[model samples]
Target chain A: MIIAVASGKGGTGKTTVATSLALVLGNRAQILDCDVEEPNCHILLKPTILTTDTVNLPVPSVDLEKCSLCGKCGEVCQFSAIVLIGKTILTFPELCHGCGSCSILCPEKAIREIPRNIGVIETGFVKDLDFVQGRIRIGEAMSPPLIREVKTKINRDKIAILDSPPGASCPVITTVKNTDFVIMVTEPTPFGLNDLEIAVEAIKGLRIPMGIVINRSDIGDSSARDFCNNNGLPLLMEIPHHRKVAEGYAQGAPLIESMPGYGHKFKKLSDDIQMIISESYEGASI
Target chain B: MKIAVTSTGKTIESAMDPRFGRAPYILIVDDNCNLIEAIDNSANVNAFRGAGIQAAKAIADRKVDMLLTGRCGPNAFTTLEAAGVKVGIEQSGTVREAVERVKKNEVSIADKPNAEAHW
Candidate 1:
């Protein structure tokens, strides 16, 4: 199943949940870190990357010599990334969303599309589980393309554990859309509860079934759980605040592997999720 | 045109509307730097992750010619430059002061992305 593990707020243990699930699921699973801007799952997994692919966005290139500055391209571009002066068709590749609307609407055909590298997607294997991550170029801001690139590395046979970036905005939406299941990790804090509402709305918009996992459950009350219960969303797991876990995290280690006693618990949670999603797809194992 | 300005919170309050969502509020301003809207979008502009597109449509709608703010990321800087909008920097005061400088054509843009990293 394609499971997107997400949290609207940063440092809320989304990566911890995603990587641990992948590690426990073994060869049956793969993990894609779609947090291209500042990906961190690879740091903990320490996978030996086997392949690397560059992610590029299509941007308009203006031919000043042959162009009549009619501003048609600019008019077509809702992004305002292209502006035509009296004789010059100015194109801003960075702001271009690669929608191809400008090129399609260009009457003079003076604008050609070119690839601008925005990021790189790398694939590796951690033991039996395959791993993929998108590394955004230092100056690039468009992460949706890179996230899509990272997702292309998924092997359908393996459990696809997607580690989404922290937000409820477009990037997070792009990562979470069409996933078989969604697992939202959150700390038991007011801020976590606040962002969780926005994330819930996004998932609802996608019409996808979702569950919750509470990290640092001991720090705050059960508001996250309360919201989930009130909303009829399942509360899959609640990991209490633990100093050892923090120490393990600081060392870039997976909790399931580091804390031996927790493996069965995570496995059970995985099995439950698989059972829920498996019914939806024929012959898919839970 | 409506413009989203990203700046230090200390000065943003004086010049922008008060609305908190994620973190760095997306201050929607008109051509005159008058507060028109505010959105919470710390993730979009926090480290300049997705500022260009997030603010592009709003600015385009306002017919703004310039984005007067503190620091801009490289992607946003180049994007705005290509769209023929002048980007100004280093002016610390109320939003009115920045708008005044923009009107006078005295504000200068950085050649590169000017955002400071939170890390």
Candidate 2:
């Protein structure tokens, strides 16, 4: 099963949980950190990277010689990437979505797609756990395309544990779209609850089954539990606020790897997730 | 100086400004607070990332030493700081009014609660 760990806000320990899960799963699982802007999974797992690939987005290159004054390309582009003046076609490569409709409809066929480097995808192995992630260029406007490129590393034979970017925006959606299941990590604060509600709405809209994993569970209020109970979603796991875990994270050691006992808990979560998925499928089959 | 403006409507007139709602254009007065040249910042509405570089470029292109108007995000704020521009905050007025406010030192910069699009 493809399980994504996501949150609606930043700094909620999504990477910690994801990396721990991947480490425990070992050869049985793969991990994809789709948080291109600020990926932190690699920081903990310290995988031996085998190969790296750069991701490129398509941008329009306008050929001025054959271009006419026709504005159809600009009109069809929802992003306003192309603009046709009296005799010049002004193109904004940054805003272009590379829909390719402009080049297809151009009377003079003056527009061509060019490779615009956006980010890089890195892949490697830490023991039996496979890892892949995307890192977007600092100044690039688009990120969904690069996130998609990174996900192509997913191996179907093994379980894919996806560490997703924060929030319910396009990047988060791009990371979690069509995954088999989602494990959302949140805290017990008013801010966390508010964002969790937004995440719940999005998960419902996408028709994806999800469970809650409350981080810093010991310190926060029980509002997260109340919400999960009311919504009929399972409380998958609760990771207490521990100082050693923080130290472990800072020292670049996977929590489950450093503390052998914690590995059992992660294995249990993985098993429980599979059980939940199987129950849902059996119910549907009946 | 050229400035970065973040309004919805196109051009200098008939604008649906996100910053001031009805103003034709609102350059971030004292753009050092933000580091953009033009007040036409579209990062909040259209972009997923890279707001600082793009917005700062628009204003920096105009040789702006200060950024003026409305909220500032950490990403944009840090980029401007590195570029040696000052950030001034809390602006809601016509672009002309903002320019005058900066000249009079009436506007002050503060961190916005969210990343972008205050309205």
Candidate 3:
């Protein structure tokens, strides 16, 4: 089963939960870090470098010689990446979505797509656990493309845990879209609750079964927990704010490594997710 | 020479819109400070991305020789420069006043964009 660990707010322990789950599952799991903008899963898992693939986005390259400055290319482009001004057809490669609309709609056939290096995906192993991560080229506006590249590394035979980026926007959606279950790591704070609600709304539209994991559960107000209760979303785990765990995390230690007691709990969490998915399937059929 | 002043209103008497990409109106004026045309730029104000490039294209479409605005971003500056539009940045007050200042050679043409992209 493919499971994604996400948080609407940043620094909410998504990497912690995701890496820990991979550690507990050992050889049975593969963790794919889809947070291309700033992937942190490798920091926790410390996977050995095996293979590296450079990912590129195909942006339009206009051939002005055979070109008709018919303004067709500009008209077809929705992002305003290419515009025909006066006698010149200007192409802003960074703004291009790589949709190929401009190239496909050109009557003169003057536009051809050229690859622009956007990011790189690295795949390796942490002992028996398979690890993959996407690192977007700095200053690249788009992350969904690179996130898609990261998801392509998901291995079906093992439990794939995707460590998603923060926020309920395109990147997060790209990460959690087709996953079997999503574990939303959050805190009890209002900021956490607010973003979590937005994220839940986004994921709900995707029709994926998701649960909540409240980190630093002992400190902040119970609003995040309250939100889950009112929304009928299951509260999967609550990890209290402990100095040892924080210290261990600061040292790049996985939650299971820092606190071995939580390893069994994460194993149980995985089992619970299986139960939830199965129950949902049964409900859908009925 | 035809000059385009980024304006908040259609008339030349309106206050200068500080933003280049999200400006509501771009009033085209002559060297004599006469309002020739007003290009509505409301569409770019709500654009999610590439607003500056779209607005630059709009300005260039009008065949303006110069642009008088409060600030010009890198993308808009590059597009305007390509279209042979001399940009006068950090010009405030009424659109007519800005045009008059440009005609008087009081406002220096910007050699580089004053603001960063998306500013």
lDDT by residue (A1-286, candidate 2, tens digit) is 7899999868878998899998888899999989999989989988899888888877788888877757678667766566553345556666677779889988899888898788899998888888898889998768899888888888999999999988898888888988888999999888888898898788778877899999888876888899999999999998888888878878988878666678889999999999988887887799
When 1 and 2 are scored with DockQ, the better candidate is 1
Assess the local accuracy of residue B100 in candidate 3 as a C-alpha lDDT between 0 and 100: 83
lDDT of 3 by residue, B47-91 (tens): 877788888888898898999998888888888988999999899
Interface DockQ of candidate 2: 0.05
Stretch of 10 with least lDDT, candidate 1 chain A: A83-92
- Interface RMSD of the candidates, in order: 6.2, 10.0, 0.8
Q: Candidate 2's fnat?
A: 0.00
What's model 1's TM-score?
0.72
- Across the candidates, what are chain A's individual TM-scores? 0.94, 0.96, 0.97
Stretches of candidate 3 exceeding 4 Å from the true structure: none
Please report the candidate that would top TM-score against the real structure: 3
Selected candidate, larger lDDT, 1 vs 3: 3
- For candidate 3, the chain B TM-score comes to 0.95
For all candidates, what are the clash counts? Answer: 5, 34, 0
Best by DockQ: 3
Clashing pairs in 1: A28-A159, A29-A159, B1-B62, B1-B63, B2-B62
lDDT of each: 0.76, 0.73, 0.91
Candidates in descending TM-score order: 3, 2, 1
